[model samples]
Target: MQLEPGAVVEGRITRVTDFGAFIQFDNGETGLVHISQIAHSFVRNIHDHVREGESIEVKVLGRDERGRLDLSIKELLEEPEEVPRPRAIGRQSPQFEAKLRSFMRDAKERTTSGAPVKKSTSTKRKK
Candidate 1:
């Protein structure tokens, strides 16, 4: 079967890695499901979610320029239709502060690097 980019498919988990899982399509095409694409939440380990030789449904998010099929299990699974339980919204934590500081540091470095950054160039037509 010709595996088109963005096609949804079901594949067998041939191997699992700390970084991602390798899947084999029914037609014998194999691809890697990047760790980041494995789940919506942070994935501490790939094996925790999928076992080797297990068949899992996935969406072919796309292929890289080299024709590597990028798979996503979370994208193929239907999200819970039930309303989410309400939690304390906007509650700040120490982790949030740490992440904010890290982002600011990176932003500062990028600004000082003298690298050209893309910006909106479209002129808004005035009425």
Candidate 2:
């Protein structure tokens, strides 16, 4: 079967290396799941996570320029929990409509001034 980018498949471990593991895709294609991508944490060896002849499910990330496939096993194994984001820096906790009104007011003031509002000058130089 033709495999599209981001597709997932099951494959058997054909080889392992310091960098990655060679896997045989079920669709007659082969892929390498990089050691760094094997899991969320650092992996010292590919053999610790995969073994020869072991069937594993991996996500088809795509092929390299030389036609070798690149696969990912991390995303295939578990779904990460959604993170709760803290308030964005420099942004006040205000409703959307209130922020919009404030922005509009500032914009109107700048436009009606008819001149570039001077930002700053040496206080001693000012009359």
Tens-digit lDDT track for model 2 on 1-127? Answer: 5566787777899988899988886667778899967987667667788888898888888888998888899877664565335455686557976989999999999989897886876667646
Error of 2 at 59 (Å): 0.2
* lDDT of all predictions: 0.83, 0.81
TM-score of each: 0.59, 0.58
In the predicted model 2, the residue pairs found to clash are: none
Tell me the lDDT of model 1 at 28: 79
- How far is each candidate from the true structure, as Cα RMSD in Å? 18.0, 10.2
* Candidate 2, poorest ten consecutive residues by summed lDDT: 79-88
Give per-residue CA lDDT, model 1, range 1-127, as digits (tens): 6678778778899988889999999787899999988766667777789999898888888889998888888886566666345365786899999999999999998899999877988798879
* Model 1 segments more than 4 A misplaced: 78-127
